[model samples]
Target: MKRIFLIAALICSSIIVLQSCSPKTTSGAPAVKRSGVTGNWVLNNITFDGIPDIAVKSFLGESSYKCFIGSTWSLTNSGNGSYSLPSSATCAAKTQTIFWSVNAADGTFQFKKLYQGDKAKNVTEGYRLMLAAADDVNMTIKSPIEYGNKTAYIIMNFSKAAK
Candidate 1:
């Protein structure tokens, strides 16, 4: 009977030692938060193929690039947005409503024109801008445009507009 008690006590003590010596497990690091792209943005700078281009600068004029400046590009949570350019001496008055989306997998930014009342036909192909960098306040996008016979990439820098 004494031998049997000793054996049971040994097993119980071994179990307690094992439980105390076991490694502790903890939760992993917290998940990273992704930055959103919905906001009003204004044009900050423009470049071509990472360098300044004289032709594009001349074409875009000193004031506006395809009527992008002065007008605010408003992006919504639903990926729908609009920008209105008032009638100016250089360009006509126009309002453009568009649907935009950014593909995280490929870092592709796409913009589809929903309505352009000034134009006779709606734009179908739309613009595909490659997202270079985007944060809460700043965004950089690259767009390939056919300049004459050669292709040139237009890099546009945008900053979040103040309320």
Candidate 2:
């Protein structure tokens, strides 16, 4: 009985590990191409879904969600990028470096902020946002959060910056 229990435990753990390590998207969606995501994008607008705007105090673990408006994000095919925030009364202006990737099948857009001398692989924590849309002209992503014991989303709107 002891040996049988141990084997069962091992099997369960192994399955969990394998699934966690899999390269698939968490939503099990088919891989989407990344061409639309690489370019200069302006965070043109932001909206709250199924929740009041006052419910969200900050975004991307940074300043208030409103501060990100008009921010310019430049993503390259090499997975390197940065977003420059415009000056706001509640948020200071700054440019932050990041390494980002989009899951081919799942539309899971993830990025990790990189500090000086920091390696992307060494950064274990990052932010994940759903890639709602992306193309040569526009892109949209949603940041999901828990609110009132229910799921809420912060919708982000982006437009390609002019050349």
Candidate 3:
């Protein structure tokens, strides 16, 4: 009888521990805001097969008329396996929200930009966000969109501020 009670107690304790260890899911609402991308991000490198590298560099660097480093943006977790940018509208004529959904196991982030227009909008405007970290270096950026489409993608990468 004593052994049976001990085993039951152990089982209950194990169940509690497992439940506590699980990660809680967000309910498609904005949860935590990403604070890492609030500042400037400079372009270090860009590559796109078939297309001219200059085009990628220009978009990533925002060199034509806009500066990616100077553009003000914000990041917020959508709680539904994605994140929203600028919970408020700040860009000119760009009343849209951008999202970044990354696989927690793979680190490959999908970049999406959703517009507020009556039209269905476009996904070609979406890109990917990648991150790499090592003992000596850490990098983050919006990667290029390879698909041919009418929308343009602005990809940029940045390193963390030096200590």
Superposed on all Cα atoms, the candidates' RMSDs to the truth, in angstroms, are 11.0, 8.7, 10.8
lDDT of each: 0.68, 0.89, 0.43
Backbone clash numbers for all candidates listed: 0, 4, 0
Better of 1 and 3 by lDDT: 1
Q: lDDT value for candidate 3?
A: 0.43
- Over 4 Å off, model 2: 1-31
lDDT of 1 at 44: 64
Candidate No. with top TM-score: 2
Would you list the rank order by TM-score, best first?
2, 1, 3
lDDT of 3 by residue, 23-113 (tens): 9875432222243333322334333444554555344222332334333333345412222122223223222355555454444455565
Q: What TM-score, computed on C-alpha atoms, does each candidate reach? A: 0.60, 0.80, 0.37
Q: Give one digit per residue, the lDDT tens place, for model 2 in 1-163.
A: 9999999999999999999898963555435577769989999999988889997877887858888999999999999999999998888999999999998766889999999999999999999989987878888898889998989999999999997
Worst 10 residues of 2 by lDDT: 24-33
Model 3 pairs in collision: none
Q: Whose TM-score is higher: candidate 2's or candidate 3's?
A: 2
Q: How well does candidate 3 match the true structure in TM-score terms?
A: 0.37
